[model samples]
Target: MLEVTLEILRFFVLALALGLFIHADRSVSYGRRGFLLIKIGFLLILFGVFMEITDQLDIPGWGMVADVHVNFYLAKVVGQLAGSVLLLVGLWFWLPSIRTMDEVQEALDRARSELEEHFVARTRELEAEVDRRCKAEAEGRISDERRRILFENSPIGITHGFVGGRFVERNRAYARMLGYDSPEEMAQAQALAGDTFSHIVDPADVERIVGQARNEDYVKDLIVRMRRKDGEIRWIRLEMAMARDHHGRNYYFYAFALDVTERKERSEALERYKRRLKGIFDSLPVGIFVVDRETHTMAWANPEALRMSGYTLDQMIGLPCREALCGDASFCPWGGIEEGVPCTDESFLTRKDGTRLPVLKNMVSTVVDGRESLVVSLQDISEQKRLEELREDVNRIVTHDLKGPIIGVINGCRLLLLEEESLDAELSEMLHLIENQAEKALQMIGLSLALYKIEAGTFTYEPEPVAVMDVVRETLVNLGGRIEDKRLAVSVLLDGGPDPGLGSPMIPANPLLLETMVANLLLNAVEAAPEGGEVSVGLEQGDPVVLTMVNAGAVPEALRETFFEKYSTGGKPGGTGLGTYSARLAAGAMGGTVELSVSDDEDRTTLRVTLPGA
Candidate 1:
């Protein structure tokens, strides 16, 4: 009986272990549901352990017989203790598995929810981007359509072609201008072919056109007679230019042409009229040059005019009138005439070789091409000018040579009267006045003689190697009395060194002319300076020798333009105005220049004289 009971207990324990193993498999496969199975299995294992303990102690018959006397109470206590331990262990393992199953299920649920939300949000963003791209494409298409319409409807003829000479596109104006019903038809007609376009050109002009277009990138105002679709020939002026492609291949040429048949006929008629009008221009015998006032260039020149100026039509076409004819630094000597004042008989022109040509010019302002222009005609009066100069020279010689002797006679008579002890007081006064008038006349004669000599290019110059410093010192000493009399201070600054060379030590120039020029400058400075004002003189040697004089007075604005002109002064009382002019002329004869400049601030005037080094 004990053996049977022990086997039955062992069988129940083995069945419980099998059930727990099944429960653990279910826990892994079925999540929270499997954990409930594990809890049920744990309870059954506890029951099986109790049954085994009862059987071992023989407390109750469980279909087994006892084989030997056993302590029922002690065995029952020991079996109950073992059952409690097994039940506790199984419960501990089952509880932790159940908790692990719960955590895994919670994590899976959260991940599923987050993934679905992310998928929905991404779909919406993609849809919005697609919509934006579609809208932008639609707007771009509309703008392109409008531009195409404008291009087709424009007034100017437009065409585009490939580098291979094939027409890619053209507009309605181009078709109509070329007498085609449509641009496509005109492009298909293939009008431009190997030099056939030259058929419209005159035989004599064909070579010129082809050569010009080949050598130059553009041709303008090319008049040609082209045949129309209706078999009419019309003169056209074509302006054409070449174009290149991205690959630098020669592309089709583009041209704008105007039907100039009427204009050409009118121009021919005008030529005939001009031939009739030629008599009027040629009859004057004097040269006539018509200058376009707006361009300041020559428009037309007569035969005699070209001869006088020594310029061909090709050389003269675009040249400024003053530059072509007059070599003067300033253009148009009749100043106010350029400002719409009619000019007549005052301005002089220069020749090709820098010679002055006297002319009687008549200018009248007129409007041409909606702009101001001058109609100028010139009459050459070079012969007349020469005759007048000759007369003046003769008169000067007669007056200057005769006046000195006359003055001597008057002075002797005055001295004789003063020596008479019985002479009346009024008589002595009259004699003194006569002597004064005679002296004035003699001075004028001397000035006239000097001017005549200068004009004739007969003034004598004696060049000698003299100490430049000595010459300057002497000039200063001679002017010391005048400087004191005028109450003006004179200062000289000289760079002292061995005279550079025979040419360096002293310049090749007339001593008298140099001294006269220096004296004139000093006198002018003295007159211009206020009482007790300062005057400065400086001498320096470089590539060229330079002498400078500065005075503490401003140049009057009125006299600035004509400062070096003969007989022009700022109206200072008793001022001859010839001193500065003659001084500059004398300097120029010696290959030197005398320049007068006012300070930028207009506070002082400076005179600079530059001469060739010795």
Candidate 2:
């Protein structure tokens, strides 16, 4: 066992000598201390192998070799050999890697220096760019300041405020226009002036402006009334806009104001002129109408026009003028006038009752609301036409009636002269009759002239105290011949009193007109009654005086409907159809009314005249 141990120790010394030699060569070449570690590691591996071999050989006096197997001994030998070779090869490979590592470190150090220099240059360039931008911004702010100063010095009013209701800026023009001496004075009194400004605006307008400022961020050309320092009101047109600042806050509101008082006054004056024009249109006496050209509809009409056409303005406006009122199918006068056609000739205007009135219309076309329209004026000529016809009839009647009377008078004179020698009492009597009739004919002509005067509204009244009974007796006496011829029985009833003189006969209304109307009514009553029929005349006195004439005759139903209409008579023989009409007109002129009605049984008809009493 000692021998084996001595051999193993000798083998270990040999392996260490070999490793030291290789490591010494590598250290000399590479000049690295790390090569010594490989030499030490090789020595430790050699020592472990040699101890195993010595135990296997069992050298004398060394120790006991404990179960040394052949395979273990061989493993020890092979491990020592492999360790020496690995140490030598490691020296060679590590020397080159160390030199290569030194070169790589040198290159890394150079690259790091270049990267640092480039980074530093890039940082400085960024700082320079930043500085340039900052300077540019500063210069831009200065330019903006100059521009703002120029704008503030101008005549226009400019102002700016913050969203939180603070006036941040205002121009001199704005402050002076609002009656302030300077912008500082206005800003110093911000709280007081703000309250005053809000108060000057209508409450609704203030709320609307505030809401718009908050929500919309802009408002423009809003006209509002503002009060000045002297308590005078003026109109202003306001423009406003909003802006956000760099801090991402909505901080500024800008506004511009212009005075519009003059314009407002002009508008008001124009409105007043329009009202005056409308008044003139409304007050015209003749019927006037205006029609739209496109629609051919009555766009505007005066009250007189509406009354003449028998339609309300609402029913007529926006309605085709002719179709709505006249119902004419062929040529509409209003439409023709609107189309600029001349219609100066006489035309008929139809009423709601389907009655046509003869009218002379004149038309002109003009522009209204930038559209062509027509204005029409109408004058009713029916009464003038009727008067002309009456004049011709009167001439004929007068000529015929006068001619007969003249002829009779001439004939009577001739007969009296020629037949005087052979004249008897009978011939003398006949000639006297002819002269009396001629005198009556002259009186009839005078009566006709009086009637014509009354119809023409030229008759005058002279009221005096007259006894009612005397007036009645006189009227009866005047018609006594006719009464006797008709054999009419007439009676008067003075009800409710023994007359008390009726206070001087009920205030003596126009005696002539009153007596004439009463006489006409009485004569008609007598003519209407059958023989033995009684006609009663009665008088009642109260606050008002009433004279009633009742006759035992039935009023024709058709005549009763239009009892007082002009030219409507009850078909009486020889009736001229003007008695009732003239009677009613005279009664109305005397501040009284005439009314007629028939009994339900159709047995009696009553006519009543009422007048104001003293």
User: Which candidate number has the best lDDT?
Assistant: 2
| Candidate 2 C-alpha lDDT tens digits along 283-376 | 8767887888778888988887887878788977887767633435576654355455555656767776668877777778887788888777
lDDT of 1 by residue, 155-236 (tens): 6655554332445677886566657688776655655544333235366665665555545577788877766555577786
Query: What TM-score number comes out for model 2?
Result: 0.43
Q: For model 1, name the residue pairs that clash.
A: 1-65, 1-66, 2-65, 2-66, 326-350, 503-614, 504-614
Q: After superposition, how far is residue 345 of candidate 2 from its true place, in Å?
A: 4.6
Clashing pairs in 2: 1-58, 1-59, 2-58, 2-59, 2-60, 3-59, 4-54, 5-54
Prediction 2 global C-alpha lDDT: 0.71
**Candidate 1 lowest-lDDT run of ten:** 496-505
Clashes of each: 7, 8
Assess every candidate by TM-score. Answer: 0.36, 0.43
